[model samples]
Target: YEFDATVKKVEEAMLSEGFGVQLITGIHDMFKKKLGIDDYPKYTMVLGCKPQLAKRALETSLDMGLIFPCSFTIYEEDGKVKVAHVSIMKIGAEIGLADKEAMAPLIEDTGKQVRRVWDKI
Candidate 1:
């Protein structure tokens, strides 16, 4: 119930940010049977990709799949909509590629876009 309400909240927030939100709702069965997130509420992930920035990042590193687009997951936690981004900076650091100064700004910008979405919620 609250989870559904949260999607409305996120949708409103995304509209205010001038970014479109794509809600992935077809993975519930997979999550329950395969991923073992049975007790977890259905997950709604918003793919927030800025066109110019993403294109620039693509130009920067062809192998930059590690941080192509940013995503934030909204789920019910204690009857609240919890939004969180999957940080690519941390992933880059884990893989020892965080030192790429050229990619820093791109990654930061992606982070900012995702943050903007979360901020509105």
Candidate 2:
């Protein structure tokens, strides 16, 4: 997909997978205006969350709140568009923020949700 199409597709896919769209913003403008960088390609950040899942994770560990909103980055680099996501649940586990056994199911469910998002987009 092209830049705008990719952003739209990701928004629809995330909604279809039950994630609420928290924010969507172009990164190029921020970089250029705030940091005085002018040579960047198109970039967008998609912030999304399933509030129920976030609640559960936080109940398991308040520190999980640090990773509440999950995000996907879509950018153009080297004449190609790319999308990237790193699992917040897994990050919490690796960083010792979530209890291993307590968060296992949440991790599994969120992973499936992201898998569907990727598959659709």
| CA error at residue 35 for candidate 1, angstroms | 8.9
Provide TM-scores for the models. Answer: 0.66, 0.94
Give the number of the best model, judged by lDDT.
2
* lDDT (tens digit, per residue) of candidate 1 on 21-103: 54445255568878887675667776655566656655765555566455666776666767666766446645664446776
lDDT of 2 by residue, 81-105 (tens): 9999999988998899988888899
Task: Give the lowest summed-lDDT range of ten residues in model 2.
Answer: 64-73
Q: After superposition, how far is residue 70 of candidate 1 from its true place, in Å?
A: 1.9
Ten contiguous residues minimizing lDDT sum, candidate 1: 20-29
